[model samples]
Target chain A: MKIKVLAFGKIADILPQQEWEMDGVVTTGMLRGQLEAKYPDLKGLRYLIAVDKKIANDDSPLEDRSEVALLPPFSGG
Target chain B: MEKQTVNTEEKPSHRRKKVFVEGPISPAFVGDSIAKHSTMMNIGAHSIFLGQVRKDVIEGQEVVAIEYSAYTEMAEEKFHEIREDTFAKYPLTCMHIYHSLGKVDAGEICLFVFTSAIHRREAIDACNEVVERIKQEVPVWGKEIFDNDQYVWKENK
Candidate 1:
């Protein structure tokens, strides 16, 4: 399966592209592992995974065309 | 013409108001917003929250400004949720929220939350709840820029 990945905040700095496509990721857990392996800097960062605009746990299932966002800690007032 | 007037009057409660501005929110704009509410005679109280960018020195470096960004789609959804939840929890007559994008200088306003109700308790409590939820739930991020051009991501405390 393929998914759309969106990166934000400090995570964007670690990931080369802010928005991109990824393949063969079926769950949020898989995506996290692949991302950390590909971008070592991501391993130490604190972030949350939002799938389809809702925060998702690592075991959350994903589908094709799903939009996944890596959100850093929120600071807005 | 009659239908249009009805729609105009009813849209505020139904439509999602635009919540993002390109830069700092000016005081004049805030004043204009308050002025527009004069015709809402039933509103007996209005609670307002303004968030200003503060200059904090870190590692001996003086902060100059903050550039904010967001996952806009998610942020909008979160804002809508907060609005709905607040309305359900309090007897508010109206609510307005705005947050800044791009660069905002120190002492400039970045967030504005206004809540109105028939009584002071509801409006004040609703406003406080909305602001608290915004800080914790919204996906907006602020990049604190230092005077030397260094920057760091701000995290909610």
Candidate 2:
């Protein structure tokens, strides 16, 4: 199964812009765990995941071709 | 029941203007905005919030300055949404919001929010809410420059 991940803000700067293919990962938490293995620096950083534009939690189900955007806490005023 | 006259007079005008500018935000421009929105019969109180950059030591590193960048297209759209939402939620006479893009030195103003209302309470509450919403929704990024010319991305807590 293949899922598209879009990283933004600080996380985007850290991760390479490329899609990853997972055989059996079906949840956002599992995808995050796979990402952690590649980028250990993101271990403690707080992040928000969105399926499309709406915010999604760790337990949110992921389809084989779903689009996900990872974002950090916003800072603007 | 005693018949009471309904004063069908039109409510006063409520104007809102928001801008996202490059480089520094001119005080003259900001002052002109306030002047243009002022009226003789209404607007008894005006509240303003100015956010300035501060130089501090973070993890034993001395910070020198900051560079700000925004998804301007999206930010403008978000600003309009915030303005309309604030107007709908509160009774405000007028509002103005402006933020600086590009490099800003320490102690320089980066964000400014001003609101006018008939009373002090509405002005204060509206000002706070608008600023908070902007911080939460806008896609603006800040890069902290260290004294040694190194940089780090800033994240909101």
Candidate 3:
């Protein structure tokens, strides 16, 4: 299944926008592990995963063609 | 018999601008906005939160400035959502939020939040909510610039 990943802030700066197709991954945690594998330097970065604008935890399941956003901590005031 | 006529005239005049922006925010601009929005009849209280840059030594490096960037489309959408939510939850007359987009130096104003309401309590509560929502939802990033032209990314904690 293919998933659309939108990364913003520090994560976006490191990883460009693109689509990823995983053969067996189905959870946010799995996607995060794949991302960290691609960019080992981001291993310590803290981020939040959101599915369709609402915050999602690591165990959240992903469906085919799901829209996910990876966001770093925000500093706006 | 006498006939009478009614005269209807539409006058075109200047309207107040809602948002203001600059590379560096001027105190004069904020003062002007406060003066223009103040009135003796409707709004009774105003609450503001001003975020300023700080010079600190992090990891033995001296910090200098901050460079801010945002996903414009998404950031605006989030700002609108926060504004609508604040209005729905509180009885506020008006609110304004402005943040620096480019490079802002140390000790300079980076973010400004202003809210006005019929009473002090609502104004304070709305102001806090707006700031919290912006930090939690907005897609803005700040890069810390040090004295030696080196940089590090700053994350909200």
Candidate 4:
């Protein structure tokens, strides 16, 4: 299935594009592995995976058209 | 009566209020917001929180401003969730939250939180909780811009 990924904060600095689509990813863990492998800088960076606007664990299932975002430590307010 | 209760319980989260401002929140705006609530006669107390950007010296560099950005779609969701939770936990008459989206200079207001209730404790506690949740949960980022044109990512401590 294809999923959309959005990057924010420090993670955005490493992503080639802030928003992009990836295919053949089955779970959040797989997605993270692929991203870190592609962008070595991501390996050491701390972030959370939010699937469809909700924070998801690594084993969370990814459906087609899921909106995945990489969120670094929040510093708002 | 059953349906009405359900409606009231669910409505707060469903209503998507605008929470992001393009730049720093103005004093006049905050004043107007407080003034507008005067019409609500039942509110006896109101707690307000204003967040200001600080001019911090880092590595001999001075921070001149902070540029904020967010995963807006997710942030709105998180804000709503926080609102719903607070409303459930407190008997607040009203609540409002606003955050700056772009560059905010040192000493400028970056976030505004207001909560009103029949008494002071609920209002004060709700305002504090909302502010804390926004700092730790919302997907908003602030990039500290130094006077030398360099920048660094900010993290909640």
lDDT of each: 0.88, 0.73, 0.73, 0.89
- As a whole number from 0 to 100, the lDDT of residue A1 in candidate 2 is 76
lDDT of 3 at B79: 75
Residue B5 displacement in candidate 2 (angstroms): 43
- Distance (Å) between predicted and true CA of B81, model 3? 2.3
Residue B40 lDDT, candidate 1, scale 0-100: 84
Count of steric clashes across candidates, in order: 0, 0, 0, 0
lDDT of 3 by residue, B48-133 (tens): 98888788789999778888876555677677777777778898877777777778888888788888888999999999988887
Q: Write the per-residue lDDT of candidate 4 for residues B1-157, one digit (tens) a residue.
A: 1111111121234587778888888888888778777777788999999999999988889999999999998899899899989999999888888889989999999999989899999999999999999999999999999988899999999
Off by more than 4 A, model 3: A1-4, A16-27, A59-67, B1-22
Q: Name the lDDT value of residue A41 in candidate 1.
A: 91
Question: Could you give the DockQ of candidate 2?
Answer: 0.43
Tell me the deviation in Å of residue B80 in model 3.
2.0
Candidate 1 - chain A - TM: 0.96
Whichever of 1 and 3 has more DockQ, that candidate is 1
Clashes of 1: 0
Position A76, candidate 1: lDDT: 84
Worst 10 residues of 2 chain B by lDDT: B1-10
The TM-score values for the models, in the order shown, are 0.94, 0.74, 0.76, 0.93
Worst 10 residues of 3 chain B by lDDT: B1-10
Report the C-alpha lDDT of model 1 over B90-136, residue by residue, as the tens digit.
98888888888889999999999988899999999999999999999
Q: Report the number of the highest-lDDT candidate.
A: 4
